[model samples]
Target chain A: MNKDSISKMITIHGVNGISLLNSENEALLSNIKDQQISEAFVFLSSVMPDLEALLAMGAVKQVMLKGAGQQNLSTFAHKKNTLCIQSDPLLSATLLGQQIRSAIG
Target chain B: MKSILTNTISLKDDEDSYLFHEGECLEFSSTKEQADQLSEVALFFDQFFSALRDSDLLYTESHIEVDHALIIANILKNGHILLTITNTAPHAHSNLQHKRPIIQTPRSLVSNKTPSKPLDKKPTALSESAQLAIKKILINYLGPASTIIFNDVYSKWGALEQPTEKSRANLLKLLAEELYTQDEKIKFQAKAEVILKKY
Candidate 1:
């Protein structure tokens, strides 16, 4: 595995309780249940409006919510060229972190 | 994926075994040979239903089975559990009163028993073994940072206590966290929860 690549960063957006992990599979941020898609987009747009620029600045990728069926959000993700992963509510935060790391690497 | 070794058979000649899943029909067979393949299938039913019960997926096993295939298909379609048995006979019959679907294997029998009260909708926490399994999966598959979120969500919802509105809320909260996080750990955990909830 490439150590430098492993250290890359990723942004995850969803409700507050969602687990967002960095490329290294580290828990970099998490949102509460009340946080919605609009809030996530606003946050991302404000912080990293230019996805390519963000990637150049050590951002490896972005993971967004695709809901349970992964039907609607998946299409949107594909259009935006973003990675969308679906998850259940009962999962632990740490597991999400590891998944991010593995996905990025 | 781990390969699990399960016991297939445990009966001698003339020994009879009966298999029943909460609401499913009873499978009965007099001789082990008479119910060989069917018994193995019945075992699968028992195991599958047992897992569902253990996970608190389905409250009562009251649904009657029309055949072994129906039971197997139901479980596979639902993806909740797996069952297997040594030997059994397949006996089909009809109930005159309610006209319910019934399947009677030689190893067991089915009756016209009414289902009990509906079970609570919430999912409790994971058992010690289940919790450990989750931990192992996280450590091995997810990384250290991801574990934190998983632990937080699990601590919040993964209880085996009585299912209630509060428990469901906690579970949903955990799921929302996983969706936002986009972590595999959360994904698998969420899948497990979904299975538990479905059953």
Candidate 2:
């Protein structure tokens, strides 16, 4: 609706496809990779407790298992969709999660 | 002759300081490392007990002779647990380690009723049409926007993944009931229940 609706490049992934919503609520970038991954997140999110528990246990903040060079996978959920955010590493993941939540709202 | 396959197991209470393990083995208190591992095991059993308490769950006293070991259980009390892993001794009668009953009958070992077939068939999940019916019910209960959420749930719980084909009907009913009860108002649960009975 407005420029502030999605200031950053936002992609709302559903079970079917990924919708990259622009500032005007338009899908300027979109595709569907694997539907199974999103469905798995939905199932797991229903049965899990807050991620804060892991955080409180002093779990690793950002766990990145590097493959050869650039291939990285963030291991574990969400109706559930995953935001494949090309996030700024310097920025807080928590803050990014908050932003994503607000955008969904 | 006590088969060398048989050994002793012990359970111990480590909830407090200086508690000894009591079972069929020599009594000894746990070291700090042992105590830590035991604590986690206690939590594990607690979760299992909680899950089984209300269900039609039952167990009989028996040992699992896996490989070369005979497992045994200990009494659980006052946040204490004990497990004894007994290893079958070498040069013992290997047949003594395990025994399985075998009954040979002509046609019907069971009652004269028709024999049930083995459960070797692939699971029969909800047909796409059946899934759509449930989706339609959900849409009516909530809103169209819920398709996204339902689709997500569908991805997670594809009806075809059920191990037993017979339970597919009941599973769909359970899923519908869960969705309704989880979000419906307390006053509306009865109505929702009535609606879900159609499934």
Relative to the true interface, what fraction of contacts does candidate 2 keep? 0.00
Model 1, A56: alpha-carbon shift in Å?
Answer: 54
lDDT of each: 0.33, 0.32
Measured with DockQ on alpha carbons, how good is candidate 2? Answer: 0.01
What interface RMSD do all candidates show, one decimal each? 20.5, 18.0
The residue ranges of model 2 lying beyond 4 angstroms of the native Cα positions read A1-105, B1-31, B58-65, B75-79, B89-180, B183-199
Residues B45-130 of candidate 2: C-alpha lDDT, one tens digit per residue? 33322222222122111122233433332334442334443334463445433432121221223355332221212233543223
Error of 1 at B154 (Å): 3.3
User: Per-residue lDDT of B60-170 in model 1, one digit per residue for the tens?
Assistant: 221111212112112433432223221222432222223321223432332544322222223334432233334334433332223344555665564544545446545
Candidate 1 wrong stretches, greater than 4 Å: A1-105, B1-152, B158-164, B180-199
Instruction: Residues A1-105, candidate 1: write the lDDT tens digits.
Output: 233422332233321233333432333343323333323333222222222221122332332222232211110121223332334433322355445555455
**Window of ten residues with lowest summed lDDT in model 2 chain A:** A63-72
